[model samples]
Target: MDMNAYLSMFIDESNDHLQSLNENLLRLESEPEELSIVQTIFRSAHTLKGMSATMGYEDLAALTHEMENVLDLVRNSKLKMDSFIFDTLFKGLDALETMVQDIVGGGTGKADVTAIVTSLQLILKSDYSAGKAAQPPLEAAVTTVDGSTSASGGMLLDEFQSSILLQSIEAGLHVYHVHVTIRNNCLLKAVRAYMVFEVLERNGEVIKSVPSVQDIEQEKFDFTFSVFTISGLTQEELQGQLLNISEIEAIVVTALDSETLAVLSNAPAAAAAEAVEATVESSAVKPKAEIAREAAPRKGQAAPAPANVSRTIRVDIERLDMLMNLFSELLIDRVRLEQLSSEIKRSDLTETVEHMTRVSSDLQSIVLKLRMVPVDSVFNRFPRMIRDLAKSLDKKIELVITGADTELDRTVIDEIGDPLVHLLRNSVDHGIETVEERIAAGKPETGTIYLRAYHSGNHVFIEVEEDGRGIHHERVLKTAIKNGVVTEEQAKQLSPDEINMLIFAAGFSTADKISDISGRGVGLDVVKSKITSLGGNVTIDSAFGRGTKFSVQLPLTLSIISAMLIKLGSEKYAIPLSSIVETGILRKEQIINVHGNRMIEFRNGIIPLISLSKVLDSPDFNENDEDETEIVVVRKGEKWAAVMVDEFIGQSEIVLKSLGKYLTNIETISGATILGDGYVALIVDPNSLIK
Candidate 1:
């Protein structure tokens, strides 16, 4: 009966329902006639409302219940979908998400959602049936805004401004009434307003400003400002531009044509008569949130459940980590026992050790799988994000995701989400072109962004590719030179691929204007550093007019890996088997000197040869005078290298241990591992050596 005991469960379920609502609402917006999607959204909202009420989160429940009322009307065919309804619902979802996040951060799940609740109330009471048959060609057949009185120019236009907007609408251009809010903590309100106006002026003309452009520039307005503007850009594109400016909290853009504009100007007079009756009716009908609270079981009472519910239990990730650590110790002891059994040559002990090895190997597989989470957990949220970005950019982007089932270590998955988000946002904002540009270039109107993941060798590769405007080497070089990222002379000597790599330089950006999504010059650099910290690398490929692709290579698991243990003179070393191609002997005659660097031939190709003894400064033995030196051919992506070692001690499954924070000076050594003989062997990072 204690709510604290169920808090985690409530938070998790709330997030799940919220994600479902977001995805389904997007789906419903696209397929408005598809009532099944509405049903799905309704169920998620209903369940969330019930859960919130039961958990004593009345604010969360009330907002959801209001949303459910509008949705209920839509599902029953009493109301139809439109831009206004969609926008309002999306706003409700956003508010719900904020409240839930607040709760997750140990605050009460409460928000000042009076504005959103009022919008939902208007949608519930307004009579759209009058305009149903003769609704003008507006995005929203039924439209309204948030304010105290319906007459307030939240988007209300005067005679002249409305006339100009009407003329623009007739010319097939879009007109929007944007309500912009600056962040409460923003230091320079006037500066933020100026930037917003600059973005608006660049895209379209501002027909009217509520506080007047002069007042806004003088910082006389509060954190919020409203503007009526007309431009050829779609609502999404204009909104996207305004959102790019820093210190702006949120913006609601309502699309208006002559009819919607007229409705706005006259909505107050038309709806005044129904106000008293609607208010009475609204109070008469109880919201689902209150009903849910009333229906909730009393303390110590068991709630009934339907038969055949899926049986599952949530386990904390820390517990799994503890389990893995315990198993690692058992594995090390098992390896030691195997060595002892082989050395003693005892039949009983050998048989028991062999049996133990088989059982332990199976256990190892299970333990690893337990820590393996599908990349889908990260990929699922992307579609909704892409939908929003595509809207803001006024570009048609279809995100084609493949290999969502691909799995990675939990730690890797946790860290990979942010980088992938940056890459995906970069693809949408910069990689893809607008609808007009695509048509001008004779390409499909809708751009396709391919997000794929797959296993290559022992690593997982996640690629973000877009079939829009690709990277322009000349433009990149020019920007690189202008930003002082590279000297003009150095820029001239760089290849196209290298020039493209310059985009990842710290504080590097090619965007003409910064937006909320990417262009602050902090995206790809952070991505590169974070991926590298996880022992991974990222690469880029592009074709000038075709598109761009970013490939990220990451390890499958950070713990326990199959490694080839070799002796570097008297010191022991471990080379991850994932990095090695094959092992063989290289004679002194086979070694080739290329530009003062040791090189060797393998598989009809040549590669650099590195001496482990010299690289690690090992003093016990040197292979310089040896007749034939044992060698291992390793690779990083397409690059190959041959490593010379004194002896191969066979391959073994080893547990990787970090070399501690103080030992970071060794770039070529990734980590250390314990050998069967209880020796600490340093692991060589093949990727670092390939270059």
Candidate 2:
């Protein structure tokens, strides 16, 4: 089999199963007695086991199998639930996840899990023995029924024994009679006997049956039944087939009743039942015989066969990307056509353009939606992570998530996981406090962390809020000063927000001790850079001793953006609409020089200005000939910077094309886009340009 083709599917399904297990385990910890939750966890483990086994990953299979066994013990009421048990099971689950990860990372999924496996096995064994001892009567009842024999002056035959007898007869071998008994708790004994008869008929023709047909039908038989059949089948095959039926007492096939068969050479099929009944009535049979029977049919039958479910075929992500690329090309053509139709001003051509516009717009929406996925797919794994972290740190913390169903472009989704993980680790390690500390501070023992997401006006906002000790502006400022990130004078003049922003400064840490959870002084800086690189912004809001919240705002998509096109000297530029505050034409007299730097006064504030041609090293044009320059006021965080351009062009949606890896060290230009005239305009990275 070409397993390589299924690799992506395997990764996706394995991830889904792991997420399910994690979420269910978190729920089980709170509602340990919830059998449904335990069952769900078991199902996930079972599925992962089957998948891994099929993939030839034995270590993953073995670990998941052990997890399933432990879950089974819990599910069946054999093992009592406790914190210790939960912890051990969670640890086992963690090991299984690690094995799966190893497989994902191109390894053989082999990990030394001998200790955990041994612990789970021992627990299972102990629980099984205890359960067996608790129901002694049940065991003895089964044993006695298994040992009883029929009284035809010959041994009675259990269903299993009868099956063997029939098989031997069919195989041209001598048939035998065996003793049989049924458990006292068995119900519907007559129905069970009938079912057994039906099975026996498959191998041979029944010659002599016991208990008189009327008495057997009226439930007058003891725990055992006898049958004589002639056929040519193997005893082993017959015994195996009968045992497969759910509840059977025992089977013993021996040489009894070997000589009791009267030749029915002239007898028809109708006489077989009567002959068996006569033999039983003539012999002295045991008065106390029990028969096990099936339970009554329930009200609701088994879920209507699962609604004849069908699955969707998964398409390759690469194919989707290619489709999106082709769509982008078509979009460019649409724009060109619209521009041409307007220039010509032909009524019929304009009408056709309008129709094409509607169709193309609809197509664009459908294509964009194809890349949309719910954020919950990523949020689902964190509950379990937070639970485990809280237990390890011996802290009481609550994780509250909202807007989990908010959707984002799949391209953005793929890169957001690591950044979110970093933020969450920071929350648990530094944002929340221990129970003792929280109580001493006159606050509730349990701290709350809120992770929220929502969409607004073509953008998405994700916020992480914690209600523990908030970020200390003084500490942040001091750290910045100590690390030489800012001068002492700069730190002194910083506002509270500016001081809080120092946390994202490189090499900044406020933790008293370095630990695996956080405080490595390498997290938030990377987080900030990552978000910024994705055309997003990260900001902090904090009140000392209250809590802190980090908000990240991102555009809806990255492939194409609505931008304001402008000309600087002879070159054109594209500024993302998401970052544009406002644009206006400014007379040359409105610009002033401050501290040897160009400045512009905008709405009562003197914002620093940079000429686009000067910053981008484009060919300098004669400012003497131009009457006025265009000013674009852009905001990075709290500060605004004005950009000078030669002329103002109208806004249009443009597809962003990356300048491949060959064009390294291009500082301020984020990407390039094609205009309707086939000219390439550079897209500006506002943050980099301003800094």
Candidate 3:
């Protein structure tokens, strides 16, 4: 099979399965008695393992197989799940995700999973039910072993080995029977056993094996295989050396003598049968579809009929982008047809144009919706992240998410993840207080971080709020002054909100020390810049002892937007309607001068008035010299400003076209759009104007 043809599909399905595993595992931790959750997680892991094997990612398949084993034991009531098991499984999931990401980035999905595999194996071998100690390191004893006993207590020996052991015992040397147990799911059993033999040979001379060393070397044995050796080292010394190797589960080094070997060599048949039975039990791995099916109903209850599965088809993003572009061109032509129909005034042309307009409007809605992805796609990964961060930071946190079904443009969704990550980390590390502090403040020990997303009008709003120690205004001002971001005098004049906003200053951090999660002086500023570059705005609201909330407002789609077109003398400009609060006519006398800056009183508050004609250096228009001016009140986040323009050209849908590379750095102009008259009009970014 040509795996390359299915590579894209494999990556997508792998990510979905991994996400399912993460979510269900987190659920299982909270509800450990829920076997159904375990079944779901087991199914996801099983499917992922099968897919990885088919794709030739053996390391991925191997790690998932080990994880599946532990899950199997838990699901089948053979073993109980605990914190250690959950953490081990989560780590395996993390490693699987990392390897899949490596494959996504055009690399072979291989990783060193020896440590994880060994941990999982140890979980299986541990005894949690009786509260007894789990399996210990290598040991030696005179008693016969439970599973198998060959010669000299437990090491199967032949005539040559018995002679060697007897001579060594007579010569006052140490002849020991060593039984090594390998992990059940070890991928390279023969190699690990070989390494054990090499260690034994370096320390001593090997005498014999139960399965005829050839079978062991060829990987023919199950979990346990016995060996007899003569070494001068003590049992402790030899046991310690073998324990250093990776996958061996247990080791028993029984000191041998002439009497013990003679008595043990006589009864090999019964012991060999026992060893064979034990091997069969340990090495058996069966398909776990039964678990998934079994969880469908209680033991005595009837099974319910299956529900209908939602139908969906995976479409490549590039194909969607192409479809959107073609629709955008069609939209431009539609607007041209409407304009020409209005000008020519033919009855048939007018009727046909109106009909085309209605049809295209419906098509536009469908196309835009096709690009709207649920925010849950971005929010689903946060719970596991918060869980890990809470563990790492030693603080208890509960993440409350709402409106995950809110949708945004696929382009916006891709860029929004990093900023949200930064904000969430900030809340986890700095915004949330420690357990002791929270207790002293009469708050719950577990801090809460709320992530919410919703749609308002034509914009989507995302908020990251925390119920912990809020922003300290005095401390923030002092740091801002000491860091040269503001003078002491300037800080004293600033409001609490403005002071709170200073945390977004470049290279600004209030941590006393740097740590991996944060406090390196590089988070909020990046958040601000990234959100701003995406044509969005972020605002902060905090009460010193209460909490802090960061609200980000973003346009629904970046490619096409309904903009309020205006004329700046001979040039036409379009302002995004999402940013416009209202439009009205204002007299020149209403403008007030505040410390040599133009300000205006509107909506019971005073805001800055910016003359677009003067700002854009218009050749034939000046709104300032006129007795009355047409002003468009626009908002950044909470800040507001009025933009003076020569004329309002009504609202229309416009396709946003990038300026390529050279003109991308322009401050006020966001992009250019083709008007119905075939003239290019630059889109104004109200965020730049307001600040």
Tens digits of per-residue lDDT for model 2, 324-393 = 8998898788778888998999999999988987997787777777888888988887888888788889
Q: What is the C-alpha RMSD of each candidate to the true structure, in Å?
A: 17.2, 15.7, 16.6
**Which candidate, 2 or 3, would have the higher lDDT against the true structure?**
3
Q: By the TM-score metric, which is better: model 1 or model 3?
A: 1
Q: The CA-based lDDT of model 3 is what?
A: 0.80
Best TM-score goes to which candidate?
1
Q: For every model in order, what is the number of clashing pairs?
A: 2, 13, 2
Whole-model alpha-carbon lDDT for candidate 1: 0.79
In order, the Cα lDDT scores of the candidates are 0.79, 0.70, 0.80
| Candidate 1, run of 10 with poorest lDDT | 140-149
- Cα-based RMSD of candidate 1: 17.2
User: Rank by TM-score, descending?
Assistant: 1, 3, 2
Tens digits of per-residue lDDT, candidate 3, 150-171, equal 3333434445446656877999
Residue 622, candidate 1: how far off, in angstroms?
11
Give the local distance difference test score of model 2: 0.70
